[model samples]
Target: MGFDLVSRVRLYKVLERIGCSPKQFDGSPSTPSETNRGVKQGCVQASNLFGIYFAAMLRHAFGGFREVCGDFRLNISLKKTNIMGINTQHPPNIHISNYQLEAVNEFTYLGSVVTNDLSLDTEIDRTGSASATFAELAKRVWENTKLTLTTKILVYKVSILSTLLYGCATWNLYSRQKKRLNIYNLRNQWKMLKIKWYDHITNNEALQQTSIPSIYTLLCQQCLRWLGHVCRMEDGRIPKDLLHGELNQGSRPRG
Candidate 1:
């Protein structure tokens, strides 16, 4: 196989490992396919970061680039359609009978391509200490009668509501209490998160210029770059070299 094909297959391998199916992708070799791939990957990247959806939860499966993008794009469209009309009636939601908050909490570990710095207790003022922060949030929770009176109920409610709304929850009560356990869970599962391919390529180029020749070195450098990009709330853009026709004809894909 050619280098470009190998690279594309590697990308497919990465996607496969993350629970994205090759069969469901609909992207073609032409412009339409590429554009759709970009959009579908973009949405999955968004959903991954927000702790709501999982690439693994995709209902259908595919085997190639088109299959991957088409499957995901269709699913995203269905979600949008379901939530479109105001007061639209949705199917009856299943009750959380055997739902343990701990099970769903695994999602918090899968990091997103984007990050939000908003606090749950945004209105409360923190006096610059960890203890102070907790105190303020507690005060705010108390001030909100709905929160205070139903702390227990809020726990279950949020867990259930999040699952119903987005289909996943990791900040649930049982998961919340097991800090060490959940923290560990988050660390281990992060690799399952989608790779920021374009950003990774750019950073790899920079590292190569600096004489960082090893693949391991490039991956480490890119991971740090990825984290910083996430901290700053940025989308992974296509590498300029590839766009400007600098990476040779092969790496740039031709129609």
Candidate 2:
């Protein structure tokens, strides 16, 4: 059942009262005491175990929700509810109203497939396949004698590339992954431009003709732009806090 406006407001109030808030952490103090050092180390460990913390918090939140539902005499559909763990080895066991919720390794949310490993390989492959399918669907546009090359390129960028690059701003990419995406993009560009493999046209030449950046460059730009936005967010924001949170002192991961 759907909640009316009043019930929604009551639910929000209940959550607020139960302390269901976003997590935040500032840098640890620089005190020299042994206790202070231990506290700092514990904080670092907790940060590393994000999956555990997330699952625990979810359990608490759902417990509060159950309480609120009982108070309001509302029935929750256990059959429709499930829990998914991300980047977690052991999935959490959550119970609502004496019914244990099933844990899933993979789930779809907002049209994106998310897996427990938190790797973007599945999303990237699905997006690439969708882009290729879209390209085939628009083959007539690419081959149409009446449409100019510029028009075809515009169509591809608007329809095909947008589908492929959805949610790319938050992707964590490495060199190998970037190379794979770039190769796929280059092949798509060649196909759209009607350049055969035997044409002897290089990837750079194709990019120059299309006036577009490499897929890696484009993703980098988007990620950097998002980073700037998060940095500029208010201090209390979760993204801002996570960006500036206390991190283990070590070399950062290579791109």
Candidate 3:
């Protein structure tokens, strides 16, 4: 297919990933703000966290953006804050907007300057074995990363399935409010969704090849690579250990 057609398809795939439909978003406006829309509590939090992870992951992988979106704004509701157990110490009632600002462009995860003297990641309750808990947490992170990566690819494809899927959703969403439809916001969401969805691809240049990447197979490859390294460390049988140890130290100590 021609590059223009391919790019258009990829754009449609983004709408599907974000639960929007092509029929609903076609010919949409150019600058719809994300803040005006009502989003579910869970989805809002997920999108915020996604911004941070995407920035960090992209930097870690060392990729360049085809285009940069400057005014992309994501609003997260403070009322639904779940510390995963760390909120009591910090007090949910405290206003985060008042504190000093620390911006992490790579990590996108923003935190307010807390005068209350509390660490966000501090452990509050010790209910499980540390090793087991660590293992479980690691597994969960890996799984989530894999799933999100797959979603990103599918969105990038913007294939026929994506178009049909998203067109239906958008049609239904706007069918209710026809007169006051904000085409501008619709288009903006498409742009934001593209950034949100193509995260892993932006990080891994290999993923941005002309052909679509296989999500499941690549995920398995990552899992195997991680597990193999872990197993080698546990068994004390990693080949060329001495060489690696020396190289890691950047020259050997002469006795």
Candidate 4:
């Protein structure tokens, strides 16, 4: 009641200033903040740093890691240290022990081509071998009138499809990829039935003729089976850990 609205606002601002900078009245000198320059990123958050200072952060981390390795008397092979940035246009040029590591767009790990874009087409290329496998036994199995369609289908499942979709249980397929797989399955079925495109047979008719499920259905079945296996696996198993483990870090802050 004693002060106007303007006076009250001014008073609040003055109190806030006094509360925030207590060191001004306490006779203690304020310490200067450490900039991103030559800063250790492990202790400091990288989000606060500018992009130009990122090299310093890398250098700091590399130096610290090398020091730790030196203390442990462990050798790091510079040739084995390769840098790859996924889904990025500009990859970072990384140097370890002053030797620049090779930057790769894709690399093979255990026979799988792990590309930067995670393209399913690369995986599809491996299906050529499955095609070859399917055709290899055409004279004895697929073409044999003595074999029932069911038997042929079973043989296709065990021989051809197995080779085609070796790691399909863990597949994260796009609509296009799913369609391609379906087409591949249907085309192979038509070939087994000796039905051509000009035979006036619909894809569904062909499916009914073979009494076979879609490739997507097979994928779902395999995925469910894999899920069951993962569920039964020991807690320390890698697959179990991958399925059930909680991440230490969270998503980046919204812009």
* 66: Cα error in model 2, Å: 1.2
* TM-score of candidate 4 relative to the true fold: 0.56
For model 2 the TM-score comes to 0.69
- lDDT of model number 3: 0.34
Runs with alpha carbons beyond 4 Å of true place in candidate 2: 1-63, 72-75, 87-90, 248-255
Tens digit of per-residue lDDT, candidate 1, span 172-223: 2232333333232232122112224454444334433333233233234555
Report the C-alpha lDDT of model 3 over 139-180, residue by residue, as the tens digit: 443234555655543443343223212212212122223212
Task: State the TM-score for model 1.
Answer: 0.18
TM-score of 3: 0.19
- For candidate 4, the 10 contiguous residues with the lowest summed lDDT are 1-10
Q: Taking the tens digit of each residue's C-alpha lDDT, what string does model 2 give over 40-79? A: 4447653443333333434556558776555554456787
Q: Model 3: which ten-residue window has the lowest total lDDT?
A: 1-10
lDDT of each: 0.32, 0.71, 0.34, 0.71
RMSD values, in order shown: 23.2, 14.2, 24.7, 21.2
